[model samples]
Target: MAASGRRTGRPTLEEVAARAGVGRGTVSRVINGSPRVSEQARTAVQRAVAELGYVPNRAARALAGSRTDAVALVIPETEARLFTEPYFLDIVRGVSGELAEADKQLLLTLIRDDKERQRFEQYLAAQRVDGVLLVSVHRDDPLPDRVRMLGLPAVLNGRRSEAEPVAFVDSDNVGAGRSAVAHLAGRGRRRIATVTGP
Candidate 1:
């Protein structure tokens, strides 16, 4: 519908599916990042999205319980040193690889304060992400606990606890940390400072 209350023939979900030569459900599955979709179907749907300039209606989708089709790898770290950490880069690479296979995009958020976390809650409450992957949280951090209370599926990058509900992927941090110091010792460095945190 146009501002003049006339139909402008704007594309609809059905049209998009038809243009992609796939069923409506298939189109939706692709749009929602369902792993069952084939790459060929995914490509066709993406082509239709580009050709028709289709923009999903968030309000309507909310009623249907459709996800916003997004995810975030939020880090509670300072922006200055965000990119300087090699571990973050490796983890990002691993995450990017998995997310790319699903054709899902990752949004990054820096939650470093009460004010920022407040704003983060507002944005997250919009249901923009299907889930969240948080990194660099402290032992006593309240963010992960808060995220769980919101009924959102969240995973921590580092292992916090076995009893903790947050799902995570972590390396042998303790063992790796020890190996790093030993390697430095063999390199003839007598003094070192572990500055992994702010």
Candidate 2:
């Protein structure tokens, strides 16, 4: 057989297969974590892969109908608040933890102004990210409606209203509000007030 030339000093799939003493298809199955591969073959392929430092080409994977394996954590707030606020930091940590387990990349984008918000919407509409995780969305924001209309996979940290159409994950704000009022009333306070945000 003819010797394959090294291209750019990166190990290729064919080379891994040769080193593992298996066919290219077997190597592919092992790399892709297919259950059909046998234990012995899988071990050999893994050893060869590690020895050669083989890294799969993500661009090629995308061309083969695979997702970009990336998600966007969209925070509709200023950069200063995103860093200063403990709430945003907790959300970031949670999202990062889940994405790390799934081996997907996270793209954090902050929308401080209308221009940047519009640009992000256009980017999402282009399907650049596999999904979106929107945080700190208010009642008046049109982003949830746009995401639903575009048929992109999205999850919100909060809902706009009780009848919100999109999927969201939020705490029981109403329950907390009621509990606060009850506590105040129990403390013999005749005057109680609540503040809300847009």
Candidate 3:
């Protein structure tokens, strides 16, 4: 208890229920956005929450619901490469934005070696996150297949090959190059020289 006669720590669900003049379950239903809650109860609970400045304990909620509401974005690259490459930075930014909109947490993971990859697989087996998003996959990388075997939801930022079996989002480099060349040729340019990296 505090000097003011209130609890010193964060407000509890029971306290909110008492303040709202409803049962504990009603408060929970209102907080969880359940349709079963009546408008009057919902309004009362919302008012109580606002007045108490209540914030839900995510870990407790996850334990109760069996959902972490989190997504792990696995990038198999060195910290130097991850920070230095604009392509990687762009992917992080885009994923962060989308995850924010969905009200889900993003766990950005950098796996640089086999040990770290093994650790991540262990974490996956623990069911720590709801889903995964993989980026910067190599042609022969087995992590994608491992994730599939675990029956976890995953999306790859880019495909390892044209016949990639996993769900992936990739740009059509060949089609893009063809379109660029056609556009350039239509403008009366014949000497087409391009630069690419290995």
Best by TM-score: 3
Alpha-carbon runs more than 4 Å astray in model 1:
1-63, 161-163, 173-198
Any residue pairs clashing in model 1, and if so which?
Answer: none
TM-score for each candidate, following the candidate numbering: 0.60, 0.79, 0.91
Top-down TM-score ranking: 3, 2, 1
lDDT by residue (tens digit), candidate 1, 1-198? 679965476678898898899999988888767999989999999999889888777556656876655788888888766789887778678888889898677787887888998888778777777888998887877778778887789998875676667777778878999999999999999997897855
Q: Is candidate 1 or candidate 2 better by lDDT?
A: 2
What lDDT tens digits, residue by residue, belong to model 3 across residues 1-198?
588897888999999999999999998888788999889999999999999989888888899899999999999999999999999999899999999999899999999889999999999999999999999999989999889888899999899888888899888889999999999999999999999999
Candidate with more favorable, higher lDDT: 2 or 3: 3
Report the alpha-carbon TM-score of model 3 versus the true structure.
0.91
Best by lDDT: 3
Better of 1 and 2 by TM-score: 2
* RMSD each, Å: 6.5, 3.9, 1.8
Q: Write the per-residue lDDT of candidate 2 for residues 31-97, one digit (tens) a residue.
A: 7778999999999999999999999877666666557788999998988999998999998999999
Model 1, position 174, has a per-residue lDDT of 88
